[model samples]
Target: MKIDKDRFNNFIHSYTKDELFYRSLYNAEREHPETFSQYVDTLDRNFIEQHQLYVPSLHDSWFPYISENEFFQTYSQNIYIAKHNRYSPEYLHKHEFYEFFYVYSGTCINTIQGKKQTCRAGDLCIIPPETKHSIAVFDDSVIINVMIKSSTFHGTFFELFTNNNALSHFFSHTLYEKTENNYLLFHTQSDTVIRSLIEDIYIEYYGHKKYSDSLLDSYLMTFWVILLRHHENHLESFLNTTHQNLALPDILNYFQANFMDITLSSAAEHFGFSVPHFSKLVKDHTGKTFVQIIRNIRLEKACRALKTTNLSISSICEIIGYLNPEHFNRIFKETFHMTPSEYRKKHTNL
Candidate 1:
């Protein structure tokens, strides 16, 4: 029997109301039990019965292998979203790319790499590549799978994740780690923004509106930041964090990009730390003081100018945030063990 389009759409729209679908399916199965037979195979168009759901079992095996190309339109985009009315039992299988899921409604019983967790609505399951996981979908539950290739995270996000936080181990899983269990569960049931953004992802994935991919990328990145920020807020213990490499490159990159006007006080304020705390953090992470970092960056620029450009020493001094040529010369020589003029002669063509 063909699914009632109206009833099917209702279940899709009102995900939390799985009982409505069950009641409808119950009525449909009363008339046609054979209509529900085709629901076993996920690839079948009739896999979703309007009024029926298969009883999920405790099967421990490999999860189904889903090809990236089947979901993604292009490798460069490398992202796709798939929704399911939770009923089938997932197997203990792993994938080649980063995969995460959002519980749209009800709960998802996820056994992740030998660990089990009950994922409720608004919970996010972050499973890294090659990690075994199985999801036992219960009746009246809906799940949305967001698949992203490893290439998608080869940017600033990777740096931020590995920027030496105490919880960094929970997020980034190495492809060739000695040991393999890695996954994260971001519990965000009370967060409205995360929930709304996730739902919008579902809409955009199916609707395919203009610039949906770009918009989704922005949303996805922001979603993780929010999740991490939420995680950071709950961090009450910092006693064992002394050994972490707090070398936040993105923060340093910002100073480099805006070196002209960045000050110790301003930089500290930008990162929401006190001046003393910021100074200590910078020193601990980079082994350089705020002034030293700024001075080193300015001197490097002066060196480049002396070699590549025909600017005079006095002009270069003024250009590199220095008012006195003698002062600039003294500092540059102290750092490089050679005067600016001598360095220029040695490296640049006269």
Candidate 2:
């Protein structure tokens, strides 16, 4: 799908309805600080329903849980992108999806896990699921907020990072491990590729056509690989100082590719670690034993085949490292509360 450059620019630069209301409120507050509170109260009394983003007291004691259904709606295909409203106040909340904040211009304050940081132009902040965070663009700044379903990360986007490096390790632990409060920030100062990729994603999103979802996936993968290859020096991660040796990305990739025959000892040897150390590392990083990881990978692949392919259950079992159809059916029922045929039939209806 292609989009006109001029139209894309106009779409991005246009002020949203909420943004207009917040801009006017910001102007009033700046012009009259002494009576700004009273003015805000008057607005609250008359037009609060139209302008109030959230109740001021909502973030005082408890952070609201933002669910995927609230913002994704029924038309979404696992991704949502929008511009952060200018002059919006800090309303702290947590969501059950991955969020990316790209500072397109000016600056914005991003509070993650209770630590405030100012992100300038060319900075991309990635917040994982269940992380407490809020973005406040109190000035004339352009911040693009891109939200992706957590299932997408676990199923598709994360499969690109197969090499043993900081990038891969961070993602593996953040996605499958027991660690919490994790995020990544990349500072791509004046990188034309990064900027262009961001624009391409936004444009593809706004001008969605046939195969736009696949195109967005390609663009996002390219954007992320570019960051890993060129901007590693400018990367900031929550687990930067810890778990440097949890290089499980390559191992996880190996399992996914060779789940039919790969053994724990062979995998350990391929990665140049002893059997004991490899098992320990896998447990520490993924919170699952070696066999459990392999089983999970195999079962997950079986699910994909059931959803997207026309293969028979016995064939899928053999393809996913199972020799016996009876065992595969038993395990599949144990995990999904349904037999493989039932699962396939249910998804076919959907």
Q: Quantify all predictions' global Cα lDDT against the true fold.
A: 0.62, 0.77
Q: Write the per-residue lDDT of candidate 2 for residues 1-350, one digit (tens) a residue.
A: 35576566566667877787778777777798788777666654345454446435232543478787665654446688778888766677888888888988888988887899999999998888777888888777799988987655655666787766666777777766766678999998778888778888888897756556667777888988998888988988885234665456767777777778999899999999999998888888777898987787788678767766789999999998899999889988997688999877765412
* Candidate 1 segments whose C-alpha is farther than 4 A from its true place: 1-77, 159-163, 166-179, 233-350
Candidate 2: segments with Cα more than 4 A from true spot: 1-3, 28-52, 57-63, 67-75, 240-244, 260-281, 289-350
**Residue 252's C-alpha lDDT in candidate 2?**
76
Per lDDT, the best of the predicted structures is 2
For model 1, the local distance difference test gives: 0.62
Over 197-292, each residue of candidate 1 has an lDDT whose tens digit, in order, gives: 676666666664555555676787787777777755533221212234444655665666666668999999888999999998777655568898
> Against the hidden reference, what TM-scores do the models get?
0.50, 0.74
TM-score of 2: 0.74
Using alpha carbons, what is the TM-score of model 1?
A: 0.50
Superposed Cα RMSD, model 1? 15.2
